[model samples]
Structure formats: structure tokens, C-alpha cells
Target chain A: MTNSTSIPIKLQDRSATEEFVQKFDTFLFDCDGVLWLGSHLLPLVVETLEYLKSLGKQLLFVTNNSTKSRSQYVKKFAGFGIEVTEDQIFTSGYASALYVRDFLKLTPGQDRVWIFGENGIKEELNIMGFDTSGGNDPRLDEPFDVATSPFLKDGLDDQVKCVIAGLDTKINYHRLAITLQYLRKPEVHFVATNIDSTFPQKGLILPGAGSAINSLSYASDRTPEACGKPNLNMLNAIVKAKGLDRSKCCMVGDRLNTDIKFGETGGLGGTLLVLTGIETEERALDNTHGNPSPKYYTSKLGNLYEFTH
Target chain B: MTNSTSIPIKLQDRSATEEFVQKFDTFLFDCDGVLWLGSHLLPLVVETLEYLKSLGKQLLFVTNNSTKSRSQYVKKFAGFGIEVTEDQIFTSGYASALYVRDFLKLTPGQDRVWIFGENGIKEELNIMGFDTSGGNDPRLDEPFDVATSPFLKDGLDDQVKCVIAGLDTKINYHRLAITLQYLRKPEVHFVATNIDSTFPQKGLILPGAGSAINSLSYASDRTPEACGKPNLNMLNAIVKAKGLDRSKCCMVGDRLNTDIKFGETGGLGGTLLVLTGIETEERALDNTHGNPSPKYYTSKLGNLYEFTH
Candidate 1:
């Protein structure tokens, strides 16, 4: 649903919320801001999600955060008194793995993929039957001395023909140096999980995956094929895998540039914006820059709880 | 000198070389590809410098490599059997220091400058008499864990109003995280030594200072005021500091983008390109992309040795 109005209609009343909810059979929810901020769960997230489930709506948690695997996310949901299966979650890491396997056409067991990220990327890629290296390696954590680096001394690994970069909490110069060596080759395919610059965490903005991805891009002078929100590839993959009707899917996210754009680009039934994330309500309504505006908006995801009846 | 020709005039014969040498009273040299590759001097560099010195030409070694200080560069020169004083060298680190002191108007000793580079940047900033922090800090070398980071616990230091980023061989996420906190504040000034993507080292293209600088820039969503080559500020600083006539000085470098554009933008007597580094004879003469073309070209810097006689 493309709304030309500068201001998104707020789903304040029960009637409007109810009418909006009935329009979609499946809901794609962004996890970081809509469900939780940092570690603590947002207010009424559990109630709202439960209410949506009660309405027989399929809920899939779509997150750009590549730090955690599907199993880890399932555990996180369980910790928060919410039950979410691995099938109900889709991460950028998983998307990257899918892109690598299906698009790049690399034989899983034969080709080694070099990862410049955390365990999430490695775990997801391994699940896809690919041999992975360089993720969370203790050797990469060491201080980078050009002359002493074993990566330079040993030369580039001929086996590793693809590099997938995601958010790495333990990012260091040594790891980047090794990744650069792989990326320097023209034949090595470069992929990034997401290009989100910064994410909201405990009222502070921290460097996101884009920072790591951009560092390599700038050094290698090559742009990586990004497999994240606003790219449409991830949404297409989800729809294809789950066999969800695009006409009955509503995307609920907190970011206009990524989540909202992703929904609009993929031609979802509707897009809902929540104010609990990176975008401000004022900036969202401002029609100055031709930004993707959400069809409906609410203060929190919990606002839909009352309309569940 | 601006050359209208698509191809730069080659300094081949003795008459052309002699004519070129007679035009400039001073020579500004780029270190890496011109004088040396890595840890070793290029062919006939000793003889080249000696010949220029014999002609009573003022020689200033200007480099974008921010890994070493002026004194360190002097040692490198000495190791190569070339006698050069500290004032005769201008590093991007030193240029950043000067920019911080003069342009940023940061008070010496009173104001604190946060460094995101190697000892070269720290040493230069300290020489300018500014209180410096976070360069080669053992604390920042630790693996970055958001929950346990001391920076997150302590919060951003209010005194650090300026962040000068350069090349750091040991760049880590913790260091970048701290830098991002400072940069998040709009009041803080962001300065970069240079933004050269990669540099050739021992037949391998390695991540340069731009990689580290870009990581912070991408994370913070801010553009840093660069003080290195192609910016013209460094050249202006050099000209003013030395009280030399711009018309009498010629720039000699290997890269066309940074080194050649720098001289061209500064309106030097001439900008000479050497094929010992990044640029090639083919790309230099392409003239399709509106790139800053060199006034003259030679196979290597050592070719100038014959002209100096």
C-alpha cells in the first residue's frame, strides 16, 4: 500500500488497528527496535506478539543483526518468555548464506568461504554445508604487524574464493588485512550481510556492520554485493522459502531507509512504522527527501495489543 | 605547470632531463614507490638525492604515510644512506598536527586530542604540545565486548573535542568504538591524515590509513576534514612554513590521484609522475575520466639522477 500522505495514519483507536490487522495474513517483524532495545524487551511486546498469533497471523522475526544465529535468537526469545522457532526467524547472516549458495553457485563442501564476521555468519554458512574460515579465529585477534603476519607470509589461500562480511565485534586490523588479501583478487566474490551504519543500543549509537563492510570496500576498492534490507533479495528469499503470499504480508519495522524501503521494494501488502527505533516520528512524516513512508504508524508495537480483541 | 597534452612529456633524452632540472629550484618527493618500496631503497636513489643536493636544490620529502613521524622518517632516510633533516620531511601525520594547531585552533597542553592511529600521529600531536590519548593504548587492544567495555561504562570523555585518524597497524574495534562515541557529538572535530585507500607493499596491496579512517567515518556518519594530499591544505602549509615560492617547487610522486592532483591543485611549478608506484603509463595518458594528469612522466625517480647532473 503506497500512501501519498506526508503523515502516516496513526493506529490509535481499536477500530483502525483492527481494520489494519485484518488486511495482512503474515507479518514480518523487525527485532531490534520493534521487539527489544539492546537487551531489555520493549513494553507489551509479548502481549502484542501473542495477540497476533491468536489471530492466526504468521509472524517471522526479520533482523539485520548478524551477530546471532537462528538458534541463538530462539534462545533469546525463550529467555524473554516468548517461544519462537528457528523457522519463524530470518537473519541477514542466513540471507547471506542463501545468496552465497544459490546465487554464487559455489559448491558447498568444495569451496571454502572466508568470513569477516562473528559466529552467526560462520554457523549459518556451515548449516548450508560450506567450509568456512576466519570467523572468530583467535589468530585474527592478535595485533597486526605487516612483516610478522602469517597471512602475508603464507600468501592468499587459493581455496577461499568468496568473502562474506558482517558485523564483527572483535574486528581488528589483522582480520581486515587477511580479508583484504582475499578481496584483492578479482575472482573472489565479496558479500556483505547488511550495510546498516549504526544501530541503537542502550541510548547510544554504536558502529554496525556497514563500518566493517565499508572498511574492506574502501581498502579493496570493490563494492560487495549486499544481502540485507532495502535490497529486496532477503524478502524474496523469505517469501520463496515460506511460500507466503506477497499480497497478504505486512512489514513492521522501525527504520525507514531499510525496513520500510524493503517492504515497499518487495511490494508487501502494507508497511507499519514503529517509533521505538532509529527513525524519529517527525522525520518519518517529513516528505522532503522522497523517503519511503510507512502506511500506518504507532508509538510502540504493543499498541496493537488492544486491537487483538 | 598545467599540461594540455593527454600524455605527459617523458623525460628521456639528456637535453629534456636537463631542461626539466633547470626549471625547478626545489623538489618535493613521495617516499614509498619513488625512493623505496619497502625497507629497501629503489634503484639509484642515493645517487639521485646526492645529485639533486649537489645542484643546491631544496629537497623536501612529502609523504602521505602517517605510520612514521618526522624523526622516524629521518632514520629511514639515514638507513637508506641519504642524509636528510627533520624539517625537510612533511608527513600527513605532521600535516594533521599542524592543521589541528592552526586551523582547528586547538590550544596546546590545555586541549586534548584523541588519536586513532600509530605512534606517528601521537608523536606529531604531542610535538604540537597537545595532550593526546588513545594511540597505541594497551587498553584499547583488548577484544571488544559491548557488555564489558570500560568505555561504555565510563562514558565519553568530554575533553576530547577532536579526533585525528591516521594509519594504525593495530586498529581494533574497541578503539573505533571509543572514537565513534566522540564523533557522535557534533561539537567534536574529525580530522584525517589522508584517505588513500591502499598502498603497495612488497608486491602486495595492503589496507592504508583510509581503511581505518573510513571505518570511523562510516560508523559516525560524518565526513572528516582531511589534511593530506589532493586537499591542498598540506601544500599550503608547507609553502607558508618554508617561505618558498610555489613557482619554484616541483612535486614528484607515483600516484596521480593523491600526489599529482595535490600538486596540480596547489599550482606547483610542475607535477612529475614516476611509474615506480601505483599509476601506470597507460592510465596516466588515458585522459578519459578527467583525472589530474602529470606535467611530466618517467619510468622511475632514479631517472632524475641523470637530469640532476
Candidate 2:
């Protein structure tokens, strides 16, 4: 996979920046490190996004975080003074919902989608017109006891056709026990919003979707189909839903393994790595992560504003 | 890894039984399924153990169940009308404590062992005289929020030399969060009692020690040294503690991957597979599980008593 282009071209040059910007009609962006880190907006992000908007570029936020719905993302974008519509943002939660509805195609009223996640997944699945159970249920909050757990005592729901796992901060043994009940069945399918092990927030590394997914998977001895970044399933869902030409899309993020690899593997027009978050310029240039290299990189997302001038 | 000896010899034959009984002086036995599954004792379990005891064979109960301590197991055995001492039982909890104290060899006082397990692990560590924290802590029951978690907010303890994981029914995001904090540090060693994904109890398959270990490993991006079953660490520990000759030791278990393989890999005198539990007689003869074949096979542990008559 090595080539002269494997060394990502720095988009600092005015002409090179212009060419890179002109090549993509739609920009798919990762949120955490690119646009903001936690609640704080990164430097010149609004200005750079505004510059892209002035040039008529379609802006779509794609994130592996399954904790927030599209509507919640719209609110988060608004909180940062960036104008974004709910339709333009795709979260792993939404992607998982799409995967369950479109890909798995469970029969309505017959096949139930069991969720081992939070309200974000429930909200997305609800928006998609799918009936789901075990999402942010207060009953799961009760301490787990093998003899008393209704989930364990009453047996599993036979109608569950698929089990979708996402980030669950309220994750407990009860939630995982119910999820394992479905996953252990040969007929039930398993899907993960993302297999990201951890995500950085507020200077603390927090357990991500994979923690929930991995626990259930380990317990059930089943591997789930991931519907997040670099999976191609999430990318296909976005492309088919938006009707965008793959040749005109670019992925921008600070993570090489997720955001950059997602674009590269999906055969998008370009992938730009930003060094404002998890990845560094040296690690990106090292070419040994086994993840696909980004086509171009800059010091930060704000550096792309230089292209407009 | 394949040979003619792969075909396990059935002990139903009188001469074969005699040879098997005469071959080993010390017998390492798995607790669950082999003796009593959950609370009830298996058929003729007492008679079989008595027969072995009458023959002057030293019997030791080695279990992957990390939720119970040696003393607890002694009570359990007593409840089942069996006579056993604390030293005769080697639970995964005790194995984990041994792993932390002897294997990792953490400096006393200066290096504390952090636990992500239940009372069993804590009790064993306390008996081993290692300073431990985070085992079955009632405070971890509080709802997880990034702003409120003391483990997350106060930062990680620098004195942690090893993080030992066992079966924790009270497993929550908070416990995992703190465990992740310690595991993320390069200096902290990771260890697991056993990686048994699920265990059968009350006709329900429940999540096992691997559920806790896998989640932490996934989040921390670290592999733990497992001290249960087929891992020679537990076997070596038992051998070292008992001062037993490997050629005089025989392992009798109802599982192939963990019990039989543990004996086989540890180069014991013989490994006997009992069909009253997880493994079927048909599967034992198939020789396709990628696990080493047991040296002998029988219908149940009770069948061994026939040799004494």
C-alpha cells in the first residue's frame, strides 16, 4: 500500500489547498477533534466551515459516538455557533438504526430490535420507525441478581431479531445479561454501532461502544457486524441516503485509524488528517499503524481556511 | 499437535481403570459440573471422592469460578456432604491473588493491587496480605456521570502495580472506568483469573470472568495474563505450592478446553474427561476441538469408583 502519495501532502501551500478544496463537493467530518473537543470549539472551525459553505460545499458530520442522536448533534453544532441541520449529521447511533432497518430488514411487528445502549440509539431507532426495547430503561438500573432479574427469570424475548450495541454509560450486568440472551441464540443477529474502545473527553479517556459490545460478544461468543467508521456499511448508508457521488466526497478528522481509514476504504475522493486531537503529525507520517494513510493532512482544521483566500 | 494418543481411552474397562488409578497419586479436579453444579451435588460425587481418598490419592479442587473464595468453597463442599479443607480448594480468586503476589511480585505497601472484581477476589488478596481497592465497593453503585465519579475526577492512583480481574456480578461502568484508568498506565500490570466467557448455573448461561476482563482489555488496549485453566500459570502454582511430582499428577475435569488442556499442557501424568458436564463423549472422541485429547474418558466421576471394588 506504499506509494509516494502515502506521505500525506501538507495542505499549507495555497495552490495545493485550493486544489484539495475544489476536488470535493461534499465534506464528511468527524466531530470530536475536528470541529470541537468536548464542549469547547476548536480555533477557526466556524470560520473554516463558513468558508466551505460560501463555496457551496455540502457539509455532513459523521461521528462514531453513539451517545447522541442527529437532533442532539444539531443542537451541539448550534451550541458552537455552527449552522447544521439534523439531516446533515450522521451518528453511529443513526448508522446502527439504518443497518438494522435497511440491511437486516427485520419484519415489522414480528422482529424486535433489542438495544443495549442509551437514549441516542432509542431515539434514532424510533425516528426510523422501528420498535425497540431495553434502551435507557430505568429497570436495568436496579442491581443485578441472577435469581431476581426478570430478564433472567422470565427468559429472553423470542421476537428479538437483532441486538444493537452502542455506548452505554449506565451499562450494568443486567443490560449485558439481556443482550447476551439474544446474542447467544443462533437466529438473532448482532450489530455494533462502533468498535471504538475508548474516546477522549474532557482530558479523560472514557470507555466507548466497544466496551459494551465486547463484553456481550465475549460472553456470547459472537462477533457483531460493526456499522461505524471504516466499516463501509455506515459509509454506504450515508452515500445511499444522501445520494452523493463517492468521487466528490472527502473525509476530515484527527484520527487516522477511524476518520481517515473510513474515507480511504470507502473509496472517497480524499481523506484529510487533522492533528488537533488523538493523532500527531509524526505518527501519521510513520506509516506503520497498518491503517490506510490519509491523502492529505494539515496542522489543524482551521488551516484549511487558507484555501479560501 | 496430533498423534495416535489423540484417541482418548475409555475407563469402563476394568484393566484400563486399574492402570489409570494406579498411575496418579495427586488428582487436580474441576469443581463445577465435575462435582456439584451450583448448589446440588452430582450423582455419587461423594462416593467417588471417598474411593479416591481410600486409595491415598490427594484430591485438590481447582475451579475457574472467581466469585467464591476457598473457605466459601469448603462450606459449599460441606453442604454437599463432602469433606474438604480450605487448602484443598484452589479457586480462581486465590489464583488471581497468587498471580498478583507471586507472579507479578508487586512490592508490598509501595505497590498496591487494584481489583475489578467481587468479594472473592478481595478476600483472597486480603489473605495474601496485599493492599487492594475497588472490589465490590458499594460506592461504585452510584449512577455514572463524568462530573461526579471520584475515580475519574480524582485521577488514577500511582501506586497500583497490578490490576486483577475476576467475575464481578456488580460490574458497572464506574468500576470499569477506574480499571481502565490504571490499565492505561504502562507501569500497571494486567491479570485475569480466567477468561471463561460464560458459565452454566441454574440452567442459565451467565457471563463469566471474561466479561469483566474482555471489557477492560478492550478499553485499555492491553492483554492480560490469564491465570485460570489451560494457562500453565495456575498449574505451576499448584505444583510449586504442593511440591508435587508432575508425573504423579492427574487432572479430572468435565471440560476439554480448560481442564483437560490444562493437564495436557502442564505435562501431567494423565488427564481424564468426564462426560457428565460440558463435553459429550462423542465430541471427546472427535479430536477436532483443537484441544489436546484427554488421556482417559468415562461416563461420569462416579464411574471411577468401580475401579476400587
Candidate 3:
């Protein structure tokens, strides 16, 4: 898998699509723009997935959204009339928890992690048997007093060895203060779910997990070891868990930065960019300087049905 | 004055003290650490100010704390047995409001400015006759719903031509969301009170105004036009209002980054770095590549009294 500066092979015709599909046994799909947009599915996506499955290709759904647990994601897939096990889904939440448990090698019961995220990450961490605090804690939502607040005193928990940050709607000053305090200790680990600055919400790009985590990063002068798409941690976790051959896998998604770049950096067999999401075909063709270019490009993921038969 | 890479002149003996004090007529003093720490006044500061006053030297109090209004600062000065008028106190809150009203030239009654700070900024902007919203608003403190929130829709007001961000205890997602929304429009002005990442609180350095503003800056991909110490807007505001000669004014502060840098960048007569605050003498003397060096160094602001006779 040599890096190339040349334009991606456009999979428009049946012959090009057939050649591209035959190269990989497993397909990693990005959920949002590739699978569906909000509550609505894209054109011919159901047929495309069904056809691909009929061809005996393994399917996996990967998303940087750390807002939902794997169980919740499976339920969402069911709502779309698609049956996917929890194992088939890889979210930033699961990846972050796995990274803390396996990579950082923190003792699940003894080591506590302070979370700056929602229930998704909390649930994942809990399932992995890690003691966690500071996420949506009712105490954190309490009023913050600058002068008399005990938080201004010796408020840090010395036992907390890691801080996991993700998309948190309940973000407040106290949580950020504690996170900063923990990060001040040189030995404490800082893990971020993903670094996506903005995610689509109601047709507008709203601040995402990266934005939430970056607030603390800026204040604390510490950077988190991110474990999501565009980073190889999520893919590495999947590859390690499933014992799949990395050379036989392909990443297919709508965004170039997260999906295509994820494949490129993670050493996946190939990357296919579908122009149904955030980026345009013109941008895919343009020389993006240092940005990773995909191996194949198509108008939409639905176009894969051409070779599925 | 010519910029020199040499170490700052240490005013340890009588001659250096007299020579340095004779150089400037108007003295701008940073309140915290120089005059007081938290709530305790530093030794000999009262006598030093009295002696400087007896010598016909003009005095002014400058602080980056946007948590209190000018009247509040005056009250604090009075509590310390210091006689100072509201005009003698210049806070980041006042500087920010003045920047919006005078420098930006936004119509006070007609145009609206959204605030992301506390009562200090709100009161200052109100005093300057500008109608503003979103600072410690009760509505903002309400729980944020990511999925169904109307903030993702047309949440921006067209009349909101400027956004002033400072320290807000009630800082929430909604305020940041609206701030980002307004910043997306190129015509909307983004003003930050100060970029101080941390300030001393109870012997610990806690997150400051810069931390709050930087969070939004990172998310929105926009840089704010900061109007605090080191940026020169506050000093410039005072200079414009008082019609004082810049060569006759000197800035005395404990922190080199805020006070000394503020004086240097604002083109004041001199900068005096005191050892009573955030930085140590070793750090002040270190060749900090791009950091502005002070013209003179003293153990504390009280040491200025050596030249009173």
C-alpha cells in the first residue's frame, strides 16, 4: 500500500466498481453521511448493504460520535430496519474506554477515570469495569461560586489516574476545573474520544466532541491522546478484537479527513470516498497538500450496488 | 526608548530607585499581587502610594479582573483605606465596553451586543448605553438539549453586531453556540476582555478569561480581537480619555506577561516588574525569547517608597 498523489479512481462504471469491490473482504463504513443523514437514509443504501452482504463481505459501522453507547447504536440500526450486533459497531465511546482499559493498562477497579462526556462514554467505561466520575454528576451541575467554592481548594482526587473527555452537553466550569487539575499532574493520562470540531445537527454544523475537549486542552496546556477515526486506535481496537487481517479490509465513508484519512493512517487495504457528505468531488480531486487521498471515489455509497451482483 | 536584550535594571539601592521613579509622572498599578494578594494588602503599599502622591505623581489602578465593575473596584480600594475615584480604576470589563462603544463605533441604542461574561461586563456595557444579552442569563443556565434545541436553528439576531466574551460563571453551551453562530458571519465583531489563561486564586492558578474565550475561538475557528492587558486597548482607552502624554506614564505590575508587556506594547514611559505576584525574579531575568522585558525590577511595589524623599 504505497501512498499516491494521483487522483482517486472514479468508480462510476460497472467494471471500475467490480474491480474495487473485489479487493477487500471486509468493509468499514462511516455511519452518518455514508449510511444515513440524520433520521433519513440515503438513496439505495439498504439495497447496497444487502447486496454487499450477499457477496459475503463483512460489514462494520464506525462513527466518531461518542454520544451513543453501542447498545443505543444497535437500537438505532434496528430503527432503520437493519440488523447489526453490538460487535459490528465501533464508536469513539467504546474506543476510548477500550484504550483506557487495554492500552493504558489501568486497573479497572483500583484506577478511577474522570470523564468529561455524556452517558455514552460513562456506560462504555462502566461496562469495561473502570471506576469513573464527573460526567453528568448532579453535583457538577450545581452552581459554581468563585469565592467560597470548595472546588477552589484541594479538590482534586489523587486516585484518579486518567481523564476521558468526549462530547458533553452538561459541560460546566467545575468539570473543566477538575480536568485541568488532574491534567496538571504530569503522570495522569488524558484520553479524548475524537477531535471532530463540528458535527451536523438539524442542517447546521454544531460544536462536536473535539470542541468540548479542546476547551480543557487550551486551559490546562495538555493534549489528549485521541482514539477515534483519523487516528488508528479505533481501527486497531477493531482489528485486534476481531483478529481480522488488516490487509483484507477497506474503509468506506463520506468524509475525507475522518474516514479516508483513517484508512490511510491505519494501514487498511484501501479507502473509498463517497461524495454524499461534507466534501465535494471538486475537493476530492483538488491537491489538498498534506491531506490523505482515497484510493477510490464514487458519487455515493449506493453506487456500490453496481458491482454487488 | 530603544529595545534592549540586556537584563532589567534592579532597583535595590537608593540611586537606581530615585532614577527610575524620576522618569515617570503617571503610574498605572496592577491591583493584584502589586498592592494586594486576594484580600490582603501588601506591606508599605499605602505609604508608597502616599509618598508618590505627595511627589505629585498621578496614580491609576488597572486590573484584568472582569468580575467587578468600576464602582465595585472603587469600593474595594476604599476597603483597603485607599482614596481612589471610579475614573482611577480601569478593569477589563470597562475596557471591553469602551472598545465596543468607542473603538468599534457600534450604535449603542440601535445595535445589540451579545455578552459571554459576568455582571462586571454587563454593568459596564449598560453604563456605556449599549443593550446586551446572554451574560448570566437564567435561560442559558437551563439544561441544554442537543437534539431538540432551537439553538441549532435561526438562533442569531441580525442586530447583534458584536460579541464580547469574558469570564462567566454561568458559561454554558447555549451562550457558546450563539457566540459561534454570530461569529460565522464575517460582519459580526468578536471582542475578548483578556487572554489571561490563568489567574491566581487562593494560592492556585485557575482558568481565566482567556480559557473561556479560547474555547469558543477553537470551536468557531475565529480569533477574537482581545482588548485587555498586553494588547494595549485598555491603556490606549485610558490614554485617549485622559489626553495624557504617553512618555510620562509608567506601568507597575507583578506579572511580566500582563503588566510589563502591557506597558511595553502600549508604549508607556516605563514598565516595572514586582516580585510579589505570579512570576519569580529568575523567570523575569530569563531570556524569554518573545516576552516583553521590564525596564526595572523591584522586590515589591512598596519598594518604590525608597525614592519618596
Best by TM-score: 1
lDDT of 1 by residue, A220-243 (tens): 989999998978889988998899
Candidate 1 lDDT over residue span B58-139, tens digit each: 9999999988999999999999889999999999999999999999898998888889988888898887788898888888
How close to the true structure is residue A144 of candidate 2, measured as C-alpha lDDT? 68
Q: Write the residue-wise lDDT of candidate 2 on B288-307 in tens digits.
A: 66777888889888877766
Q: Residue B269, candidate 2: how far off, in angstroms? A: 1.8
lDDT per residue (tens digit) for residues B164-272 in model 3? 9998767777777767777778899999999887776556567778887887887788999998897887887789778878888889998877888888878888888
Candidate 2 or 3, higher DockQ?
Answer: 2
- In model 3, how many backbone clashes occur? 0
Q: Which ten residues in a row have the lowest lDDT in candidate 2 chain B?
A: B1-10
Candidate 1 Cα deviation (angstroms), residue A269: 1.6
**Quick one: best DockQ, which candidate?**
1
Off by over 4 Å in 1: A4-6, A306-309, B4-6, B306-309
Residue-level lDDT of model 2, residues A203-269, one tens digit each, is 6777888877888988888899999997999898889889999889999988777888899888898
Which one is best on lDDT?
Answer: 1
Reference contacts preserved by each model: 0.75, 0.68, 0.38
Worst 10 residues of 3 chain B by lDDT: B145-154
- Give each prediction's DockQ, rounded to 2 decimals: 0.72, 0.71, 0.50
User: Which has the better DockQ: candidate 1, or candidate 2?
Assistant: 1
Clashes of each: 1, 0, 0
- Using lDDT as the measure, what is the rank order of every candidate, best first? 1, 2, 3
